[model samples]
Structures are given as C-alpha cells and as structure tokens.
Target: MVTRRRLPRAFFERPTLQVARQVLGQRLVRLEPEGGRLAGLIVEAEAYVGSEDLGCHARAGRTARNASMWGPPGHAYVYFTYGMHWMLNLVTEREGFPAAVLVRALLPTEGVEVMRRRRRGRPERELTDGPAKICQALAIDRELDGHDLCNPDSRLFLEAGPGVPEQAVTTGPRVGLNSVAEPWKSIPWRFQVRPEYIPSLAEEEQTP
Candidate 1:
C-alpha cells in the first residue's frame, strides 16, 4: 500500500510560477468511496499570476466565479471552459496574490485500469495527457471545486511521487493562449513529460 503524503499548505503559499515549475512529477491522489486510491504523475502545468496576467481570471478581480482563486493557497480552483470541460488549478501564493498553477497534464500510474474505463474508449495517448483529458481520466469535476488540497480527507489531494529529473522534464510556451503579449506569453512555463512516456496517439485508434 502506498502511504500518501498530503502536501503542506506552505508548499502552495508561494509564487505561482515557482509552484508551476516545481509541481512537475508530484503525485495527484484521489480518494475513492470504497477506500480505494487513484493517483497519477503530474507531467504538465502552467502558471497564472494575479491581475497582471491578462490570461488569468483574476484580471477581472474577485468575482463569484473566481473567488476561490483569491482565497488562501492549497485550494482547488476548478472551472468550466469552452462550455464543455472542467479544468483543475491549484491555488498558490498568499491571500491577495491570486495566483494558481494549472494542472495541464498527467501520466497515468496507479488506477490506470480505472482511468481507462473512465476514458470511455479514448486512446491511451489521450487518456491523461491534457487538462480536460486528465480531469476526465481522473474523474475530477466541478463538485471538487474549492476542496482543500492540503487536507488528507479531501477527495482530491497531492503527494510526493517519483521525481522527474530536470533532464526528463521539458519546458515550453503554454498551449491555447496566443493573444497574451510578450514575456508572459513567451514564458516557458508549460512543462511536460519527456517524449518517451507520452504515448503516440497517431499510432493507435480509440478502443471501444
């Protein structure tokens, strides 16, 4: 049995950029009702800083929809996007900073069989490699919003996992945001797993 270690609140009460870069290779654990456990290796993430970041929700100040992002760190900031999918973000920085780290991708590890079923016939490569895809693969949704990431009792939390060495991690510009101006948009904040573990979706068809 794997003993999960919930990350301390202090871990998240820092700069979002630092959290985003450092969160690579951490374990994202989900506790099931049947006392079962599901986990995956965090492979990709992006940082969004306060109002200064035009791409961030905080740019509009603390609205009802984004109030959680303005709260203390170590909280989940789940939000719906494209009227289709829910994206999971981990709030970071102090109470007023309003920063977060978007968990962009994960590599299925524990509970892969369960994840495959949840994917509902998606290809393995598409299983847990993107934000929406990972939420689907890991069964994360709006109900999990505002949950405490530092609480062991929370349905979703993080833990220490296999370390992805610096060499195995790659940094690049974040996906889907081309409008933001220089420096911020060009910042290589997005991190992904090395090419090896990332599956080749082109080579396989979805299994039904």
Candidate 2:
C-alpha cells in the first residue's frame, strides 16, 4: 500500500542541498476546492542556498517578493516570473534564512484528469514536467505563497513516498541561468531520479 504520511517540519529544517536530494520520490499533495486530492511523485529538484549564492534569488537579499524565503521552513516560497509563470519553492533550513528547494517535476499519481484539464490537455508526460507546469497543473499560484506545507489541515502539503536510492539519482547545475557567473552556475545543485525508479501504486491505491 502507498501510505500518505505528512513529512514533518524537521524534514525541511536541514541543509538546502540535502533537502533537494531527499525530496525526490516524495509526493506533493493539493486538496482541491472540489474535495479532490491531487498528488504526484516529486522527481526533480534544485537547491538555491542563501544570499551569498549569486544564482539564487536570495543573492539580491530578502525583498518583498522573496520575504517568504526568510520565513519558517516547510512553507511555500512561491513566486511569479517571466511576467506570467508561477514557480513553487519549498522553504528550507532555519527561519530567517533564505534557502529553498525548487520543485522541478513530478510523476502525476492522483487527480490526473483534473491536472490535464488545468493544463489544457497537454500530453501526459508534459503535465507537471517543469516548475511552471507544476504550478499550472496543480493550480498553485501566489495565493499559495507562504502556505505552511507541514500543516495537515492545509490545502497543500507533502507526503512521504518510496525512497529513491542515491545510486539512482543524477545531479547537475540548476537550469536557465545563462547570466549567472561560473561556480554558482556550474554547481551540481539539481537532482533527479528517472521515473522508473518510482514504483507505481496499484489501481486501488491510486484512487484520489
């Protein structure tokens, strides 16, 4: 059986890079207004550490747009970008610290039809494949910014899933940072595991 256990606040109160790697194989869950549960297996993540990391938003220091990053761990530090797309980042490490793991992609496991409709019928594999697409597919936006993910009563939260072994993971530099200088640009902060590494839930266990 696929158990749905909420990850504790302590899970995110660790180093940013460690949280990024460990988040893979966990499930992002959104309890919809229509009383449906939408969830997916997180497959990719990228860590952006504190202010000294030039490639990170915190590099500019904490501004109104990024204030949530300085809040308690296990909260969502969602933001808008490209004047259109919304990106979701889960705050990590100590309170007042600006560090988070950007959720990059997911393997949709529940409420697939709802996600497809929200994505306007994109190909199955394309849904929730990117950070923006994940926000789009799950209806995550700025309204969810600063939301406490560790709260079971909250509409959005994360659940433990199958553990992805270290050997199955691949790491690389964060994507879309052409303007960033070297070192930060080249650092292996992104981590991912192939979808096959995630075991499929039985049909009965997949009902949302």
lDDT of every predicted structure (CA atoms): 0.80, 0.91
What TM-score should be assigned to candidate 1? Answer: 0.88
Q: Residue-wise lDDT of candidate 2 within 1-208, one digit each (tens)?
A: 5798999999999999999999988889999998999999888999999999989999998899999999999999999999999999999999988999999999898889999999999988899999999999999999999999998699999998875888779999999989999899999999988656655422324545
Give the C-alpha lDDT of model 1. Answer: 0.80
Model 1 segments more than 4 A misplaced: 1-3, 197-208
- The residue-by-residue lDDT of candidate 1 on 88-189, one tens digit each, is 999999987788899987766677777888889777667888899888877788888888888766879888665466777788887887887777777787
Error of 1 at 78 (Å): 0.2
Best by TM-score: 2
User: RMSD in angstroms, all models?
Assistant: 5.2, 2.1
State model 2's lDDT.
0.91
The best candidate in terms of lDDT: 2
Error at 57, model 1, angstroms? 1.4
- Evaluate residue 111 in candidate 2 and report its C-alpha lDDT on the 0 to 100 scale: 89
